[model samples]
Target: MEETNLYYKLGGQKAIRAVVEEFYRRMLEDELVNEAFRGIDMDRLRNHQTAFLSYALGGPVEYDGRTLREGHKGLNITSEQYERMIRIMNDTLRTFNVADEDRVKIEAFLRSVKPFVVGQ
Candidate 1:
């Protein structure tokens, strides 16, 4: 049987970038989470996120960014903010026609990493 992998199903780097773009666009427009991004350099953030997601999804490229915990340090992110970001990501995946199973896998991956991102 052919193996299933999120990287391939997500169409590799290109698709990952697309999803990140849409996810950020949604987040930037949402008042609830937008405050977290204040004073952040969006372009740099996007590049780091694209690489991180690509690597997380098991794509060909690796993330050259900071470790998740280090990266999120001092951010003071709450569980609600984390869930909001995940919701935006899921919506982006749906917009890209990602299979439901794959979307679920993506979400599961995010949840697994939540501790590194939320709270002190």
Candidate 2:
């Protein structure tokens, strides 16, 4: 199956949105992660995160915003921070009952974005 086809078959837009929401919720409650999100507009950040994930997961939505490196330019996000974000995302996917195959795909996609995200 094609990559995009796999995303749709795995539940498409709605499922991706759910996973993003849960991931942010976990970030908000975890003090270490919460600090990174502090002072940011939760609703706006959440929406952008959703859009980014939608495009990354092979959905039809076209992402046109700044690339992750530029978007995260001044944040100075560390490797540890990136790892925490991935961990939270994986846990959120698990909570949503995402199948292992889909989870693996998502993880690979996220990993590919890490360097850009941290401006490495």
Candidate 3:
């Protein structure tokens, strides 16, 4: 039997966009997380995030953006901030009613990218 990727399991691009929007909203609302986004272009970031997440979730889209480390470089993101971001992402997934198994997979993906995102 063929395995269904998380992209389709979570409904696809539209669904991913919704999750990204909600995730950003929550992030911006949080003072600590919001600082990282200061001076950044939110609209562009949102678009890139949507595409990145779609690709990460196994959608057919290609993400040609900067590597995670490069993108987050000089941000000085701390471990506490990273953990908060993870919590926010997980909460966003839960808000969208994503399956537990799928959330676990996504969490793993996030953890895998931590080295590239934090303390850059």
- Score every model by TM-score: 0.93, 0.87, 0.96
Clashes in each model (backbone N, CA, C under 3 Å)?
Answer: 0, 0, 0
Would you list the clashing residue pairs of candidate 3?
A: none
> What stretches of model 2 exceed 4 Å from their correct place?
1-6
Model 3 Cα shift for residue 99 (angstroms) = 0.8
lDDT of 2 by residue, 6-70 (tens): 45755877777777777888999987667777689988887888887777666778898888888
Q: Write the per-residue lDDT of candidate 3 for residues 1-120, one digit (tens) a residue.
A: 114999899888999999999999999999888999999999999999999998888889988999999999999999889999999999999999999999999999999999999999
lDDT of 1 by residue, 77-100 (tens): 999999998999899899999999
Q: Provide the RMSD of all predictions against the true structure, rounded to 1 decimal.
A: 1.9, 2.1, 1.5
RMSD of 2: 2.1
lDDT of 2 at 92: 88
Positional deviation of 14 in candidate 1, in angstroms?
0.9
TM-score for candidate 3, please give it: 0.96
The better candidate by lDDT, 2 or 3, is 3
| Top-scoring candidate (lDDT) | 3
What's the TM for model 2?
A: 0.87
